[model samples]
Target: MRAVVFAYHNVGVRCIQVLLARGVDIALVVTHQDNPAETIWFDSVAALCAEHGIAVTTPEDPASAELDQQVRAIAPDFIFSFYYRHMLPVGLLAHARVGAFNMHGSLLPKYRGRVPINWAVLHGEQVTGATLHEMLAKPDAGAIIAQTSVPILPDDTAFQVFGKVVVAAEQTLWNVLPEMLAGRIPRLPNDLSKGSYFGGRKAEDGRIDWQQPAQAIYNLHRAVAPPYPGAFTVLGATTYVIGAARMARRTFADLPAGLAVVDNSIFGVGNDGQAIAIRTLTANGNTVTPEQLQQALIDNPH
Candidate 1:
């Protein structure tokens, strides 16, 4: 069956690749230009599509008339959106002769908005799933077509969780695509009232608050830690990225919530009276050991 795919990021690329391997003809691929501001370590959907000789279009607007004409010309049997950046307008949603579905990073109804993986880690969710759902006018409010979950370990970084999600997304699509193409896909409504929606996170949002609980701070650290952006804290004029940390059993009662050096290791006292052992620290654009951070703090105690 011929399909029109709107995709970006690693998960998107993988989904497209799997479909191509299954011998599904891709009529058109709509993707986005890479963001120059962020460091990209994931596979590019555009590049992958080009390598397969699929027609790829990078559009700034999902609702543009030019894209409409292209979709109409192809008259695809299926339209799949995998981590595509923008919302598809109702006009395009109707273009699919068979079905239109979207693959989202989080389980249906929860973490509906952008960066669901990071938000799940930040919120300390023990389980999060990848969802493939019916594409509706409202973003991620679509009925669930298929879903598969992965566990979130206590110490799992957002990047690690993201890796699991990528795999989950691919498997979900693989399992459901046959039924979807046959017009036998099931629809389970996502109760909007029971779910939560979160906004997109920025680098500035990674700023850590020492006064929070130790576990909270640790969650923040792993939630935005590298390959995304490191959670940061400022001491004097120096800003340190909290690369790695663990919640300590003991709390320093006398120490105020901020920087605390104990036994040649760096710690941050939380307002909850607990301590977080700062394992690896990034200072002056370099990752350093705890002892090195101790020395830096002593040398520049401003």
Candidate 2:
């Protein structure tokens, strides 16, 4: 099948690989340029396209008239979007004579918006998956073609969960491509009423709230750690970023909600009277050892 692919990130790279392996003629690839301010940790769809000699474009606006003409010129049989940041306009979708499909990070009818993996981890979801669905005017509100689910361990970070979703996206597309190629497309119901939609998250969303339960606080940390923004909290006029944390196994008497240091381990006592062991902490972009945190606590005592 001849196709125009709008893709980005590792999921985009792998999904495109699947299409190529299936002998699809990728007439064009639409991708985004890596933002200098953001961390570029995943495989690049542009690089993959270059290796295969496919034409690629990094347009600031996917809906521009020029882009519309470009896509129309290709006259692709199908259109596929995988992890592409921007929404493809209906005008672009019309260029696909066969169909326009999208591979989403979460199961259809659940977590159906931006950064699905991170939202799932933030909400402490037990499971999340990838779904390949028909593209509609409304984002992620389309008929499901196939899906592949993965488990979310209690302590799994957003990055770890994203790795699983990438594989799931690849598998979901691989398993369903043959049926689509044979002109037998499946249209499973995507009950939007049964699921929730979430907007994109920001760095400020990582601010930890001490009044929350320990597990909730830990979930926040896991949801935005490292490659994503680390969860933070202000203490005594200083902002501390929590790089790693886990629910405290033991109890401590008379400890109130907030930062605490006992022996040499740093802890964040939640309003629920529970605590989380802060395994890695940082201040002003510098790592703060437990000893340093203890000394700070001693000097401040606030």
Candidate 3:
């Protein structure tokens, strides 16, 4: 199956490798000309493409004249988008014989947007998954070809979930590519009513409001926690970045809500009418005990 693949980041390249190894003939690859995070390396894709001599383009827009010339020349049967950042234009879609497809990192009709895995964990959902669908002009609103769930255990992190989605995406591509390229792809329309959309979360969304339910606060923390911006709170003049934790009440007398019960976790009023706890935290270039933060409050009264 001849295809034009647009991708970004290491995960994108990994998925590309899986497709290529499965006998999909990749006509070209498109990504940012430069990467802000050094981690978004093309070494893997570059090496493979070099070995195979497949052309790569860093198109500002997939429909640009230069990009159009390349695609028109290759005339790929399909255009596979795996984490492509830009909203793909109709001009590009028209260039492919078999149409274009997207690999979304969520179970469609659920978390449908840029950061599905993060939003899923943040919303405290028990599970999420990967989906392969026909791309439409709208963001992530497309007919679904396949989906596979990844369980969201209590301890699961976005990073871990990201890994699961990667596995699901590669598997989905393998399972569906043959049918897709053959012009026999079987897909069902997404239930618009059933699907929900979420916007990208900012680093500020990590701010923990102590008044919120312990479970809700815990959910937000988990959603943005580590390998990410992480939850933070302005204590006096210092900004403390929160990490993982559970809900617990140490003592009614000494424990302060929204304060740490100990070195254990972030404190809150659980909906169950008990104290709450958060496990880890960092602040002012120092990782300290929750007690230290409390003492800071006692000393400075922020």
Cα lDDT computed for each candidate against the true fold: 0.87, 0.92, 0.75
Instruction: Please give the lDDT score at residue 219 for candidate 1.
Output: 89
Which 10 consecutive residues of model 3 have the lowest summed lDDT?
38-47
Candidate 1 TM-score to native: 0.94
| Residues 48-110 of candidate 3: C-alpha lDDT, one tens digit per residue | 567778777776777688887888789998888888778788787778887788888899989
Query: Cα miss at 170, model 2 (Å)?
Result: 0.4
Q: Rank the candidates by TM-score, best first.
A: 2, 1, 3
Worst 10 residues of 2 by lDDT: 250-259
Q: Is candidate 1 or candidate 3 better by lDDT?
A: 1
Assess candidate 2 and give its TM-score to the true structure.
Answer: 0.97
Each candidate's clash count: 0, 0, 7
Tell me the deviation in Å of residue 135 in model 2: 0.8
On TM-score, the leading prediction is 2
